[model samples]
Target: MSTIARTPTDDATRADRTWTLDPDRALPADPAVRPIAREIYAETKALPLVSMHGHVPVEWFAEDRPFPNPADLIVVPDHYLVRMLVSQGVPNELLGVPAAPGSGVVAETDPRAIWRRFCAGWKHFRGTATRFWLETELVEIFGVTLRPAEDTADAIFDQVARAIADDAFRPRALLDRFDIEVLATTDPAWSTLEHHAALAADGYGDRVVPTFRPDPVVLLDSATWGQDVERLGEAAGEDVSSYRGYLAALRTQRLRFKAAGARATDHGHLATDTTPLTDAEAAGIYGAALAGTLGPGDADAFAGHMLFQMAAMSAEDGLVMQLHPGVLRDHDRGRHAVFGPDTGFDIPVVTEYTRALRPMLEAFGHHAGFRVVLFTVDEDAFSRELAPLAGVYPSVRLGAPWWFLDAPDAMRRFREAVTETAGFSNMSGFVDDTRAFCSIPARHDLARRVDAGYLARLVAEHRLDLDEALDTAVDLAYRLPLAAYATR
Candidate 1:
């Protein structure tokens, strides 16, 4: 490594002044490798985003309203930002995060105060992917050059507020500004998709679509399971007083999702188990669930059996199946009670996939109509299970490193782990996977840079030609997700 002598003045200047993002922020650090990485990155950087899987609210696009103040828009709702501060003993209420109904916690209502809290705790986000995305949003989207700190917080906030006040900053405007070709919002199976249909009527049907999420109904042990099941039956216009009716309701709902331009079905169960239950066993479990007297292990067994059934439904209906498992959501019971869900106490445990998914794979692995993209927070499953499974199964494709593992190094590790076995063809392109709308471009940019660096290393080692690497970068950045989640 070349030694570049630094002075104390440089350190002082960097510490206190406004900063600009480096053009080559996340490129490979190697002197020889970086230039190649930059070239690959430049080619893919401006490509229209293909967000085939995400959690952005459909109303944002449907209403097309200007976003709220900076804090409400960026600070309060982002679980990534909220969790880091909470980890440092900052109460969620102190950041304007509302308590659950009857939790009796009065949240901070002042947007500027919440923003200041975020800025004051900014150092806690150092070296995290959240920091990268936040910084990018601040500088690129809102045009804030000032660093996020206590002294600069108000200045930065004012700049962002002024920027978002423009008509150009509205949700639908940003969809075009962000060059988002296809944005998929996660929707419950019971949803009427009124917002999606509204967007469709406004001619955004092809660009903004919904992905069917059936977690609340499938994970049968939830306290609201009965109500959620009833809602599902109502949505599908099916009588779900029996197990067969429940199945029909789900199938009907999936078809409705497809009719609304949905291309995929999303599952976030705690495990990847997909063992099919016998007809009698499944019916008995359904009856118990309906009666609110389910036996031990019934919920887990039913969830698994439902996953198997989901694959069969996918085979018939052609909704790309997306599964990201092994998250223990709302890990802190007290925090969950106060904050409901997605205030981020989700933790990942060991997730086994080979045996867990064997039953589903055996039935649909070679089916032409079936496609499943497997994602996990457990990196151990990457090389050991995911790569090998995707290598052989035509229906299975490896999802991008997601959730807790979506950082730069983690993404690089994912590429290293699976590329050798499954190769690029069996990998789904990047998915932003955020509820934070402005962070979409930032997240996708980070993924592209990390991928560019990974491919540059391959090129530097003479394993992949520069031309081939360039094409693969475009595939990962633009084309792959389109193909992987294609409705047709």
Candidate 2:
């Protein structure tokens, strides 16, 4: 069997491979809206990026290393692109996924061949957000003018390889080029924050920060929970043998993360359930979790109670709390066992927040110092639950349409659904929420055009005047996220 994927025709020559992108691709097409959209996009398009939440590793900035190659830099570590290619029958091994941690299995396949395989299957991404981001990286970042295809893959790869060798294309240089003013990384409570310290020591502290994420400790059944708690104890220099000690240790870690420049805490779970247990109930569950004798429902009960605890802590410590729930992680058991978490199989499930979050919302909805930004993957919840929650709660802000729903059409739908209830001011603005570093600008650019188009439609409808539309567009793209995730 052949290793490379094949497209219908590989005969297209350089002259025939015309894939030029229009400067106004995602802008509004209606005559009434186009003018207004263009005006709004012009002002907000060049604003500095505030990446308040993302998965990009700080070590990339700390080490300031050159990206190894084109395929590794662009293809691997991106679940969106990998899932699409995998659906088309491409194996992860062929896509440069390391066979083992610190293993050189990726070197077994030639990088150029991997690029050709991806190019050959480029049709799989034709209308996807992945295509938009990849095309942007190719043309705008690497200066490549040709469309990806079997015929042009090698040439495009060579062009990108040359660009990667430039000192200007190194991680730090690209951070400046990307104009990333403030970037937040997802880190656990136990993280040494060594990379963050390194950047601060190097005078880059103002630019990059970590977000506290404590899922492992919160989820009772996570295989590493007991071990992670030990590490947390070590990090906090506090004993975690009792329920109160555990809480105190957690608080200690949160303070440490805040001192390390974390402005928010991120939580992801299988459900949106935020119900709180009474103190005695919570202490009993914590004891069971530590003893490894927790019942089937105990894990979820404990997790839900911890969500309330986290929000309470946020109120006390003044860190914005971010919740993105309703994902059934590692839907494919086989892939998860082999490749580990975030391996592109975390599928979305229907979740209810109105009843689930009542306990926490009732307690903290109007707390003076508390802020909760809620994100959802289920579109049905946007107007039905999330928007209405943000509409009334002084402490709540609607997170952007997240993960699976962050695409163009979904983004437009999000604006329409949530704006009527929460309005632009109650929205968290655009969050790339990405690990693919090169796609950050492209993601933000797409969000800006979508927001402009949404506002332009409002202007055309005369529901909003032109000047106000322009202001709302800029706030949605720039000001809102800055204010929402601001360090408290």
For model 2 the TM-score comes to 0.95
Which clashing pairs does model 1 show? Answer: none
| Runs of candidate 2 exceeding 4 Å displacement | 1-18, 100-109
lDDT for 147 (candidate 1): 77
Clashing pairs in 2: none
- Point to the candidate with the largest TM-score: 1
**Tens digits of per-residue lDDT for model 1, 1-488:** 01123455655324356567888888888999999999999999999999999988999899988888999899887889998998899999999998887888999999999999999998899899999999898888987766788888888889889888899999999999999999999999899999999999999999999999999999997768899999999999999999999999999999999999999999999999999999999999999999889899999999999999999999999999999999998888888878886764899999999999999999999999999999999999999999999999999988999989889999999999999999999999999898888999999999999999999999999999999999999999999999999864
- TM-scores of the candidates are 0.97, 0.95
User: Which candidate's lDDT is highest?
Assistant: 1
RMSD of 2: 3.9
Q: What is the C-alpha RMSD of each candidate to the true structure, in Å?
A: 2.4, 3.9
